[model samples]
Target chain A: DQQVKQNSPSLSVQEGRISILNCDYTNSMFDYFLWYKKYPAEGPTFLISISSIKDKNEDGRFTVFLNKSAKHLSLHIVPSQPGDSAVYFCAASLDSWGKLQFGAGTQVVVTP
Target chain B: DVKVTQSSRYLVKRTGEKVFLECVQDMDHENMFWYRQDPGLGLRLIYFSYDVKMKEKGDIPEGYSVSREKKERFSLILESASTNQTSMYLCASSSVGFGTSGRNEQFFGPGTRLTVL
Candidate 1:
């Protein structure tokens, strides 16, 4: 069974628009959540993360919102640029030092 | 900067052949992980090691074995290659005090595309 899921396989947005990517999880034990962006022929790089205690965390143009009660999280990118096009993965972990459980991933396409 | 290097960018092996994939991390991290990435499966952990000579099985560990003789190097061995094992393999490393108060992010390698024919 998949503990974390990204139902949307892909998402597209125009430049300078807002792009939202959603993710859901079934495991309640997960206390930490992270988002990673991956480019073609390269590895997934760390984006932004939020602890269970926080509802939102932002980094530059990217923002991550967590809803523990709903077991859901969303990534918001404002003024999305063409360079933001890539695959996004959502991962959850019980402990900061433990292994992570990753979702299938959502491919984001930002058009110029 | 954390750097994780894999032995190869691509490899092709025949069935029943023994294949070895090597990974090296320059961050002196205590945690190392091996994962396989498929088109729709994202990334699945095959094995992980927290310390030298200590290993743990991840989500999928069948037909795979790992070795960590040194802190900087980790090896994944395929007892006998199979067609179904063809996929992209990724190596990642992170420090022990990851998360909470320390650097919990993992650094990944360029990845090795393995094809078993």
Candidate 2:
């Protein structure tokens, strides 16, 4: 069963605009959520994350909002740059657990 | 920087061949994992090791075996390679593994794409 799901396979947005990637999960036990960005020919890199305690976490232009009651989360990149164009994966895990359950990635393209 | 290095970038092998994919981590992390990436399946875990000589099976572990004799190295062995096993193999490591709720993020290596014909 796919516990974590990224419904959109691809997305396109203009540079200097906002890009929002959405993810949904079926398991309520997952206490931590993370977003990873991957470029071609490279492994994924960690971006931002949020815990169940908070509804939102922000770092610079990137923000992650979690709606634990809805079993959903979203990653928002404001003023998205061309460098942000890559496959974004949403992952969930229990806090302090090394094993992660990942969603199918969304390919985000930022146009100039 | 945390560097996870895979032993191979690409490999072509015939079916029935014994395959060994090696991964090395520089961060002295205690947790190492092996996963296979497919087109729509994203990343599927095959095996993970929390410490030397400790191992656990993940979602897709069939036809695969692992060895973690040393903390810095984790090896994935395909006992008999099959055509379906052809995919991008990724290795990751994390420093935190003791917590039951959550762990530190993992550092991934450039994947090794294997094709078994």
i-RMSD values for every candidate model: 2.0, 2.6
- iRMSD of prediction 2: 2.6
Candidate 1 residue-wise lDDT, B1-117, digit = tens: 669999999999999999999999999999999999888778889999999999999999999999999999999999999999999999999887756533487889989999999
The digit string of per-residue lDDT tens for model 1 on A21-76 reads: 99999999998888989999898888988888889998899999999999999999
Please state the Cα-based DockQ of model 1 relative to the true two-chain complex. Answer: 0.61
Q: Model 2 compared with the native: what TM-score?
A: 0.96
Q: What C-alpha lDDT do the candidate models reach, one value each? A: 0.91, 0.91
Residue B114, candidate 2: alpha-carbon lDDT: 99
TM-score for chain A in each prediction: 0.97, 0.97
Output the number of the DockQ-best candidate: 1
Q: What's the C-alpha lDDT at position A107 in model 1? A: 98
Q: What is the lDDT of candidate 1?
A: 0.91
